[model samples]
Target: MAQSRKKAVKKSFDPQEVLDFLRQDELDYPAGAKKFGKDAIPFLSDLIEGTDENLSMKAAYLVGYIDDESVGDVLKKAAEKGSSTIRIAAAYGAQKRSPEVAEAILSRSLEDNNPSVVKFAMKSVSSMKLGKKLKSKIDHISKNFLDDDIKNSAKDLIKKIK
Candidate 1:
């Protein structure tokens, strides 16, 4: 009986069930965020070009957590792709991963010509705790982007740069 029981033990997880679950939306973004981690670099690179701007942006945001250099490229592209929400999220994501990418985003955002994007970009940069390196970049943009409002906002970030 014990031998029969051992041989008859059923699998707890069915492969087909796993595939069906993976097809759900809730299982996609944040779940993808947790599972892919650094291994998502290649998948994100492709997702950036997807027709769904929201998905592209979501993928971009998650890609930043990958802690890989390629995430910078994807984030930069997302910021330039006209999905304001995605750009802001990617900017913040990049801020946590790469200072250079964050700086590039701030440069565009500081002088963005789009008030909303500039506002979001300023907010994102202000949240960065990147020390002197980010401070110097902020100073440069503050002086150069100098649109009064954007300059003042960047100054606020400079004060927080400690």
Candidate 2:
């Protein structure tokens, strides 16, 4: 009897193929796309700026996992102007960047009309170590928001910050 050894094969990273995978409606594509890291930033940036909302959202999520600082501005822009889903993805990505940059973008997202965006923003706010000014803003949100859930989230975030 002879024993055979199996060799592992390494596949090259293809930015276009990663983008295509992200564009699909399947749940695993984003995780699969994240393996490209900084190499995927350019393609993800283009997708974030593109017209396809589903692909753009997935790109935004993957861009967040990449550790490139240049993507911050793109994520901020998407968070400000993209659709609610894109905004949520952008917010998630923005939180992975520098806290100073992310804090400002997340703060602005708190004003978004979409509850999901606001909720994501609140979660980001809670996770970070905030300054006096930002804490005051969260306190204000807790006091003034008409939505009970948002108000409670704000209040809970304030408690966590303190």
| Number of the top-ranking candidate, with TM-score as the measure | 2
lDDT of each: 0.62, 0.74
Q: Write the per-residue lDDT of candidate 2 for residues 66-122, one digit (tens) a residue.
A: 767777877888888878988998767766778888887787787777778878887
- Off by more than 4 A, model 2: 1-13, 24-34, 131-133
Model 1, C-alpha of 26: deviation from truth (Å): 6.3
The alpha-carbon deviation from the true structure for residue 162 of candidate 2, after best TM-score superposition, in angstroms, is 2.9
Q: What are the per-model numbers of colliding residue pairs? A: 0, 0
> TM-scores across all candidates?
0.60, 0.78
lDDT of 1: 0.62
| Cα lDDT, model 2, residue 58 | 84
Candidate 1: minimum summed lDDT over ten consecutive residues — where? 10-19
